[model samples]
Target chain A: MIPIDYYIIVSILLFSIGSAIVFTRRNILYVLMGIELIFNAANINLVAFGQLDPYLNGQLFSMLIITVAAAESVVALAIVIVLFKKLNTIDLNEITQLKEK
Target chain B: MKLIEIVFFFFAIQLLSSALVILFTRNVVYAAIALMSTLLGVAALFVVAGSDLLAVVQLVVYVGGVLILLLFGVLYTYRDPESYFEKKHVLLSIVTVVCIAGALLFLLSDLPFNYPQLETSPHDATGITKRTGYLWITNNLLVFEVVAVFLLVVLVGAGWIASHVLDKSKKDV
Candidate 1:
């Protein structure tokens, strides 16, 4: 069996990449993709930790996370669609109408 | 080298590099494809880690359902096939990535984790699946039903907002 440390390292790497994409990307859709990556990294951690326990509770939580993530993407993409229709662009920087001028 | 190590390395490399491609790719379509590859790699990792049911869920939900929705969302929003990346804040992203990595390494190294050696104990994959189903019905039933309700709400809410936008667009036309 491979050491769980390696899996943790991979999770951290992917999480950092996801965070970087979220912070730097102006495209709203790509930011959502980055969010998905972060969700995945967390899932990896959950599954890895579940391997340590006999009850497999972590795997159960990871399943819940996956379900929530699917629901989140549906609602978020719908909002993105509405934003694009209203603003005519998916650029986050350009869609600052809610910000105080 | 053991076969398990090789398989682990293969999935890890595929997962990381595909994710990097997703970050760097300027084209939305290509990025979506890369995201699919990354999801597939993660599914493989789930299996390698001995969670076959989660692996299947990862494949079905992330790869099949969400990725398709994302691709449709991408294509629906943009008429200009080429969706360029936001490289204006690359310096900020680099700094953030470094800080996050440092923090993660610091935090990860200090954690005391005890991994029990289950080498002699052979666990059946099918048994795990059966136990998971039993858990869902017995202990985790509430959470399961809540998620179902959440999905229903999301479905209705998404359709509502989408049609609201369409109605306004039609009115303007």
Candidate 2:
């Protein structure tokens, strides 16, 4: 059996990588992918802890998270589509509707 | 030391490497494909951790639904196959990530999981699938129903937002 620390360390590393992706990448798509990585990291944590619980609240929360993430990705992609349609680019920095004239 | 540990390490490596691919790859589609493998690796980890239902959900919802939607976005939004970041925050992000990860690892070093079902099926062990259904109907009925309604609303809203009507009106204005 693997120790819980393995799960913890792995998730932590993933969370960090996801954050790095979000910070470093200008492409909104990459940002979305990073967000997903972060979500999966949390899911791993929840499932790992769920195994120890008889009631399995952690697992239930993980299910909820998966549902929420799916919805979020849909909405975010739709927004990206619209943004591309209107602005013709997906780079976060190049989007400047709110920038001062 | 054990078979499960080896399996766990293998998947951990797979997940991280593929995720790194997403970070490093310039092509949006390659990044998307990497995301798929990273997710599959996560699902494998879920199975290794013993939540079969979650593994299936992760596969079906993430890889099937979100990945497809993302690829469609890619199709619609494909300008050049390649775009590069103008200002590289790579060093800053790396430093920040290292600090954050080191802090988390430090905190985790002391924390321990007292209850371990990792080695054996428990005395009152019931199938997670069965318990999930029961919990939905019994304890978490409100949450389940609300999430259903939320999902419907979010999808409908996204469709409306992306539809031609909004596009037409904005063009007219």
Candidate 3:
């Protein structure tokens, strides 16, 4: 049988990688992808623990999370497209025209 | 030794490799493709871990819906891929890596090594589908309906925003 710790370890690794990508990447879309990665990591953990419980609510919640993620991607990608058209660049650094340094 | 063990090992490798490729790739399109692979591997892992519903949902929502939208976003906003290299922040990247490593170390320290003793037989465990279906329709039906409605709204909103941006850009040119 596969151990639960292995799942936990994979989750942590994916989460940390996602965090790293979010912090370090300049592309706003990549940052959003990183956020998705983090969400997936959380979903993995939830499903892993859900396997332990008898009611399977964790599995249900994970499905809900997947739907929410799809919605989030749509909205976020739309915003990114609009921003790219207005500025002609999607780099996070270049989009700081509104910021008062 | 068993088929399950071999399947788990292969899927884990695929998940880790694809995830790393997604992170390290310089091309946005390639990274997106790698992300797809990672998502598929995760879905497989979900199946192995006994959440068949989640596995199907993961495939449909993430791979089918989210990834297509992401690919559309990338294609719509095409810039020179190599032009993105000018704004690298070395110090912040180092700090972020160090902080993540520290957190991972702390989490590793607290994990219990002993596996929990679960008593459900394989045949009975496979009956999760019937149980989950009853729970969904009986008590959680409303939440499911709400999510479907939310997805519809999001689709309309995204289409509107993208088309509006395209029209304005055409007028500008």
The interface root-mean-square deviations, each candidate in sequence, come to 1.7, 1.9, 2.4
Specify the CAPRI tier of model 1.
medium
Instruction: Provide the lDDT at B73 for model 3.
Output: 84
DockQ values, each candidate: 0.68, 0.68, 0.60
Task: For each of the candidates, give the backbone clash count.
Answer: 0, 0, 0
- Candidate 1, residues B71-159: lDDT per residue as tens digits? 99989877553444444666777787789988998998998877765542133435468878988999889999998998898899999
Per-model TM-score (chain A alone): 0.93, 0.94, 0.91
For model 3, residues B79-171, the per-residue Cα lDDT tens digits are: 777777544544555567568867886878687666465544242446567778888888899998888899899899889988987897788
- Put down candidate 2 lDDT per residue, B10-114, tens digits, no spaces: 999999999888877778899999999999999999988878888999999999999998888877787674455443565666786788789888887777646
How accurate locally is residue A49 in candidate 3, as Cα lDDT from 0 to 100? 75
The residue pairs in collision within model 1 are: none
Q: Indicate the worst ten consecutive residues by lDDT in candidate 1 chain B.
A: B118-127
Q: Give chain B TM-scores in order.
A: 0.87, 0.85, 0.77
| Whole-model lDDT, model 1 | 0.85
Candidate 1: tens digits of C-alpha lDDT, residues A25-55 = 8788889999999999999998877876667
Q: What proportion of the real contacts between chains A and B does each prediction keep? A: 0.71, 0.72, 0.63
